[model samples]
Target: MPIEKFAPISRAACIGGGVIGGGWVARFLLAGIDVRLFDPHPDAERIVAEVLANAERAYGLLTSAPLPRRGRLSFCASVAEAVEGAQWVQESVPERLDLKRRVLAEIDAAAPAEALIGSSTSGLKPTDLQEGLTHPGRLFVAHPYNPVYLLPLVEIVGGAQTVPATVERAKAVLDAIGMKGVVIAREIEAFVGDRLLEALWREALWLIKDDICDVETLDDVIRYSFGLRWAQMGLFQTYRIAGGEAGMRHFLAQFGPCLQWPWTKLTDVVDLDDTLVEKIGAQSDAQAAGLSIRELERIRDENLVGIVQALKAGQSGEGWGAGKLLKEFEQRLWAQAGHTAPPVDMKAPLELVETRVSPAWIDYNGHMTEHRYLQVFGDATDALLRRIGVDLAYVEGGHSYYTVETHLRHLDEAKLGEGLVCTTQILATDEKRLHVFHRLHAGPERREIATGEHMLLHVDTSAGRATPAAAQVLSALDAIAAAHAGLERPAAAGRAIGHKARLATPA
Candidate 1:
């Protein structure tokens, strides 16, 4: 097996400033890659700016990894100027074959020979996309989902002239920027993910056309049902688990016969005739009520972030599917933040986590609830682990730290939207044990609101026994412990839960 290495590209060029193109610009810029964009439309710059703003907000809620400084976004006057020195060039013009070929040819002519040229076509074949190009081998389909910055899936398709190296290079770029690059074995129009999407969409249109369900009802049918499952495990794995003890083979045996049933309307697409179009459009308008397209997009992005983060919270072992993808993306964020098990300021505790309280953390009393404090502390602990080199990959290797005990002291309340920071001080450390204290402060004045003392045990997960941590992790822990040895012990440490000393002598 050939191991794939990640190759980071520092600069990217985006041609076309429509929705997909704008999203590409945002993804590249947020990944710390400078972007040179070329789009003749008058509103191109404005559209890209809006997309970038939305991406930044959505990503802020998605992860806390220290992100690199913002990469510069330059709007170039011509395609040649945009791809002049770009390490990667992406063409995201309208879904017209002739237009794409012209734009791609222009990009291929200007981009450096080593630079990979990717088309953001939803369904166009790569062979068609590469036609009339000088270096067709460098061109491939790198289709991404909408709001590309948050979604990690990218379908990579290679044409007849495209070599394995070109496909690998595209994969490297996608992986480096925190995406799941799934290569199609053969070139096909619409690729894989979109084909599945189209099937569902076609079925949905037919159902709505036949008045079987309205827009809101149909959306509810999915969102309130299998949509949740698809966000994590996906269809096959979900059905496999539904097979119970018999597993996938049993599932196929049970449901295999249904494949021949004429139950699905996916065999044909519904014509969008005037009457059907009006009905669908009216139903959609009613579903939207008064929300603008931008508002709707915001809601969609927010929900996606929350759902994906929920999946991330469920990751364990070698996390599968979307949960695994979320974990990997977060790891990339941490790595970009420059966090490592290295010597730091020995004089004071390390401030590991900083975030503002979200509305979801607020309770009926209008302040952050008790359990929210624990969530923050947990995030802080995860940050501490990451700093000590106990990241996702490390834990996946069969070594991890499990919290054996915890004591939380809620001295004050944290209000919604208040800035909170968690400073961690290592109290004690040994080969297999770690003792740490965390202080959670709120607001600009750093008013102390909560504190947590924890005892964690390093365990060899594969052996199901406590074990000494890796040398690098131990060194990092010991360094922090040594630095804090001179500081006064926290009064909250080692405290038992008792209101006061009771006068038990009378009893």
Candidate 2:
């Protein structure tokens, strides 16, 4: 099913607020779904708060697309209270089977009849977890990776008693929240992802025990080699590229015999005695370079943001893999924000974009950098274009407005976390030309901080020449132009830079 068809749930219940549960909370809340959390841990509130903060920071750097308002978070005293009125109930308790079954039973009795129950078990089968539950049909395993808010994949595994509709609903709900849910064919311990990971993990442990490589060296081997290829293309596809003129079939024919090699001892379990444990622990600590867990988490998130953004710009700006999901998610957000042009005031410029200065936008000097200013103006331009019916579909239809010229004047500095608003004025427009001016304001007082004047030319992307826009776009532009015809023109409109030489003052 297409991701855009999915509808976001209104509320969710999170049981057991550990790292995984907190991540689930952050994901739901950021997607604008209210959350009721029940965790007996003394530091549950603090842990969730930190996770949410990190998630928010990563999101700010992840995309320039407008996001929905964050949903409210409430801490409940019991599982029954948390599951009340919740359409989705997630159990992220410990990995023990008995503990998970007990929690699932409590949740099944309290959660709404229509609520879909999910467990964050890494290896336990859904059928085993569903045991002792009143509504086993609605329960399934939704295993997610660490730092769940940033990693988008979720494994959806159904049990023997789980209904088919439950898996479908789980996938749809995950899509609505900007997640990629892959339903397993059948219930199995550790499912797909963990199985793949465990193989490499066992091999790495054996290598360390044999004194072949340290933790940092092993990590470098992955991150600097196949990991990069895997980031954009998975294992099979990477091998396909290795085939050169041929593809996967030829590559497999040439290297398939290597599978019988004795290079890996997958079946041999390593004895993790105290000496081995201490050795691995010391090496791992050295690899960390004394950085705290939170500090390392922030670094990881920033790097992930960069990778995701780079992928989002791939495939000619359409996005690739998880980046493709992000593009669709952003489109949904724009739709929810009401892209249609609203009633024009006829006396003032239209407010098109509202955002805050993200942490990534700051420079070493602690002020928003020069390029970020251009990014904000560009976002404002995109917003204005969308308002006039020039959206993704419009561009895909073969025509778009390209900014031919732009002049920007900066009046003040924009610091991190400061609110920004960009108002656009339709100075003039024709079938093939659009002249607009944008004023950027900062903070609650709405002080003007910058101005951008631009001339955009409508062009047929396929033909590579100027062309008239579609009838719908032209009509929208004409209406807005007529309304603003009587309005005063901006003083900065049509201004050009000029330089004058001055003699130095006499000392």
Candidate 3:
């Protein structure tokens, strides 16, 4: 291993606070830097806030190491002011060649020569961008994806005048911001992402122009199949795996011929007729009909939160994908919710439950899904099963609770981020059957979240037949329930499920 000291990263500055600029600020600020943003746009504050909100989800997806809370983010009145105390500067000005050239010169004059300057340019060669600057070699392209805060890829391209040490410095900054810095040893037009996307986009556009496929149909093709695989693994690696027992060599040899096939031209070029553009735009708008971008963004973020949160809860030796990033995410959440840190119960349950609800569980009214009522109740039954010695290991030993039926009722909306708690009660039990009930409540305020009742059958996984809880486990559960005797029976069991119907009871 090479020996090198990891430099300290405490602050960063954004020279262009547009979407990319704001995203860069959030990525660094959330990682605990005093970010100074200088955006000429009037909506800079709102843009930054929105970007930060999206970045939070991405941050969680990227790390699990404990990171400092989001540092002080301030709006600087001028480019010079923003660079005052920054250890690094990410310039994301307009894409015009002149604009980048002018900004790079200004940054070189205003910021310290030792401080690394990174440009969020797609494909503008670093030499061209730094040509007129006093310190041209210190600047390099740190190309990032749209949601720079979440996606880990940062294409680091070098220009003729770029210095090796400066490139390394830029990589260090990318590391601090929680990204996988892929170095493009030489400058290339259109960069990596834009080129790859453009390839696909060109083909899609060709299809549209030729009337071979409509916009929605083309989108559906990607979303239904390749999108799922791409989410977990990209094209090359995915193909390598798909090569199967024969391996990539054989697979590629067989499929390589397709590369020469007359696939529609994507890069060659095509005239984007007004009619086709209108058709695609109209289709896109229709797809998002009655959707508010703000609310849609919220839902999108909420989904990201749930997915990353799930990744963080791996069985063992997991979270390398996002465990470290989650550490930074926790800090940001704490800051937003106005809390100190992720709370750990003083006497946390040795074994309890963490139930879940997916995006589909959300209703149009923006609340706890109606069917989710049943799912929550189902989770409660499992918790009770654990209490009675039917843990996962026990279930593996061929005995489990099988829900025979359920009744559900939902009251009030469970907006995104609403904290939830549930309590399980054993209504009745026998060798063949276990009757259980559970109440799902929202936060400490005791708002009615949802309710569900379930009648379950005890079964042996091996025999797949009715069975009984192990003697020891059943005894422990009976003892625990007796210790809290006289605690109100959850109202759902006594009568039906609802917020008002739920009576005061033991949690």
Ranked by lDDT, the better of candidates 2 and 3 is: 2
Pick by TM-score: 1 or 2, better one: 2
Candidate 1 wrong stretches, greater than 4 Å:
1-6, 239-269, 313-317, 332-349, 356-372, 378-405, 411-419, 425-436, 442-448, 454-507
Can you rank all candidates by lDDT, best first? 2, 1, 3
All models: lDDT? Answer: 0.84, 0.88, 0.69
Candidate 3 structure lDDT: 0.69
lDDT of 2 by residue, 1-507 (tens): 433333578899999888899999999999999999999999999999999998887787677676777999999999999999998899999999998989999999999998999999999999998888888999999999988998899999999999988888888899888999999998899999999999999999999999999999999999999889888888888899998888988999999999999989999999999999999999999999999989999889877776776777789999998788888988888766545444546567888777777656678998888887778888888887887888877888899999999999888998876778888888999999999988989988999999998899999999999998999899988988887888898876767775223345559
* Model 2: per-residue Cα lDDT at residue 506: 58
Clashes of each: 1, 0, 10
Clashes of 1: 1
Please report, as a residue range, the 10-residue window in candidate 3 with the lowest summed lDDT. 344-353
Ranking by TM-score: 2, 1, 3
Q: Please, what are the lDDT tens digits per residue for candidate 3 over residues 324-392? A: 355444444323332222333312221123333444356787775676666556645655565456665
In candidate 2, stretches whose alpha carbon ends up further than 4 angstroms from where it belongs are: 1-6, 339-351, 354-373, 387-402, 409-434, 439-451, 457-492, 499-507
Candidate 2 minimal-lDDT segment of 10 residues? 497-506
lDDT of 3 at 335: 34
